[model samples]
Target chain A: MALSTHTTTTGFLLPSIHSAPPFFTQQPNPTTQSIASEQWIRLILSYARHRRLFTLRVEDAETAGNDWDEVLRNERINRRVLPSYLSAIIASMAAKNVAAYEPPKQNRSALLYWRLPEEWAEVLHEWAISTGQLNTILTFYDITDPPIESPLTNIPLPLLRKAITILAKTNRAQLIGVADGEGVRFFAGSK
Target chain B: MHRRGVGLAAFDRQEQSKRSFAELSSALSQSQVDHLHSQLSQFRTALAHFASTHRDSIKNDPSFRHAFQQMCSSIGVDPLAGPRKGGWWAEMLGLSDWQYELGVQVVDVCVSTRERNGGLIEMSELLRLVSRLRGVMGGVITEDDVIRSIKTLQPLGAGYQVVDIGGCTMIRSVVKELDEDQTVILAVAQLNGGRIVEDQLIQQKGWTRDRARAALENMLLRDGLCWLDDQDEEFGRSYWVPSAMQWDI
Candidate 1:
């Protein structure tokens, strides 16, 4: 049978290589493994962007129904990436800086950087300016769980803090202590 | 014939006539030599003119190029030989440029897809990618054209070689040789739609399980010629030779 691209029920199009069974296995050759790693990295980051998923856990490969299911498993071929292989791919992603282990010290899970923190910083600033929230004190809750949905909605806390930290370097945002959690005040900083 | 030579003067006269005859023959052959030279130059001029006029068709038309190449071979000329090497057909046709450009593309596709296929690509897939790289302006290229372009790449010593396995043509970009077992595995994988298991090899080729495993493992670890698929429903593990596999993309 010809290996072809398949669209998942959730509307993500898996590349044709995804249909190939070897793609799920960890290749023995470093060169071949690198190819698999790159494909997985690209698929993961793109899927994360498509579904607004910010985190990938190795345990997701152990079971279905996670945000990574559409990519980590290929039911048509009766194949799913082993947790070992998924962990390797994640580690490669981490080494390449496309992802980072969230909470700083553990390696089981990572925050997927579909958009790197630098890019997220711009998005956060732009949203603050457009929504007339500039120069206002907004809690992390206000940004992550906005009244209306946002690009930042459901963004993991660690990634959000990274973006905020990046912005603070430019004086575009300042961290301020709040009653329940920390808040941030945005400024109409110069480019 | 009229009278017998009577003295030394008669003998000297006979010698003079013989020398004159030799001189006449030499003069006649010199003219023939000059005529032959002009004829050869005329042939060269005509071939050069023909090459210049139909250069585009020679580069853009596959059949025409094939026919032209056949004609060149029949006439004992190499279509690719350059002027520095003393053959003018390539120079006048400007076909070598077209050919070298194609060689570059052949390498491009082979090198770019090396990771996926382990430096061995199916011939048809190589042609597809090369034609795509050339875009519409590159015109149609045939299998002969690809083979010819590959020939031009020989001097680079990059170990690009065309190998026939399982009745399928594959280009191997790496220098490694396909051992006897690996060759058989590739042939069987081609028959299996790129999937092969130890049982399949044992049943079909009568190989022991250990032999099958060793060959597949070498392909996977030593050459990167095949990929390991651990989730095969029947065998639980299978080997896939990407060069034998048909990739639609």
Candidate 2:
């Protein structure tokens, strides 16, 4: 009974049930399976958010090559989540708006939205105002992968775009299409 | 003639004495009846006072509570009856409605989850579920409370009974009675982590191959206590007990 939780490199504490063998297996009963799926959804979102992972591919998750993919399989217990069960869990997550299909039509992969675009927009605006980067043009890469310590560092481009779009809707920020990439110009006092 | 008159006087005297004796006996019996009535009332008052003072203990302690109910029944007092029904014992005990509400919730939890658990649930698991169902409004429901509620459910013949197997208390819905063979299989399965194989039973319990097979099949088909997996190449056919599978989650 040495069941224990694993902490991610980014300091996200995975729940103890993550390592349990049965957690990977699909429950045969509908009610219990639904609960298991809900738990799986919660775990995926939290893990993705903690490690700032924006996308989760079924292949990547099911494979043991990636360190972060340990959640999908418990090797010590020799239990690997079936692909069908994983797809069902992802489908349910998509239904709940917690995740979206990567290509919109294909269910092969999903972009986890632990924090919705609206929430990310608020976080971005707050960061800009506090850091005095308002009223200046910042490239998408600069905003997502800033050299200095910032919460928005390493944000996925698609999620970043969504967040910027939310700010654009509120007239707090404007998007600039450059020859190479896109840039966002935040307006001071336009909150 | 003088002798005849004397005899008549004596007969009259005897008749008068007999009448006086009858009156004396009646008066004596009436006083005894009054004394007995006073004693009964006094005893009832004392019992009521005792119940009120020890209400908490009686509610929390299983054995004590059982004894208290027995005592009440012996005196023709129903402690489980509604308080507003003017039963002195019920009012003093103040556990009737509480027990009744818990009983209703227990039945709900048990009935709703019966399909998954096959009408058999570990006592601790049942308590956890009942507590979750009741939420904040239900306060605390102890093991004793569950037992007491199950007791109240006995009259309904809902097949609610507590079974002790391998030192763990399991509540089995008597709707489907488990015969001796099924009971033995369940006990064996509990020891093997909610799973049992025909070979294990035959080897350990010294049962013949036919007897083990019959018992296992009966449990799977009739009692719904097991799930069969013909996919097990090693075991041939493996029976798994869902209730005994303790998922930490």
Candidate No. with top DockQ: 1
Grade the docking of candidate 1.
Answer: acceptable
Error of 1 at B146 (Å): 0.6
TM-scores for every predicted model = 0.77, 0.59
**Cα interface RMSD of each candidate:** 1.0, 5.8
Q: lDDT per residue, candidate 1, A67-130, as tens digits?
A: 7788888888888988988888889999999999986798889889999999999999999999
Residue-level error in angstroms, candidate 2, position B93: 1.0
- Candidate 1: how many backbone clashes? 0
lDDT by residue for model 2 over A1-191, one digit each (tens)? Answer: 33457765557777755654446656555555665677798898888766677887777655677645657765655556767778888889999999989878999788888998789899999999998999898898888778896888888788888898889887899999876789989976455
Question: TM-score, chain A, per candidate?
Answer: 0.97, 0.87
Q: How accurate locally is residue B164 in candidate 2, as Cα lDDT from 0 to 100?
A: 80
* Candidate 2 residue-wise lDDT, B26-70, digit = tens: 999999999999998998788878888888878667678889889
Clashing residue pairs in candidate 2, if any? B159-B174
lDDT of 1 by residue, B3-50 (tens): 869899999988998999999999999999999999989987888888
Model 1 stretches with alpha carbons more than 4 Å out: B1-97, B134-139
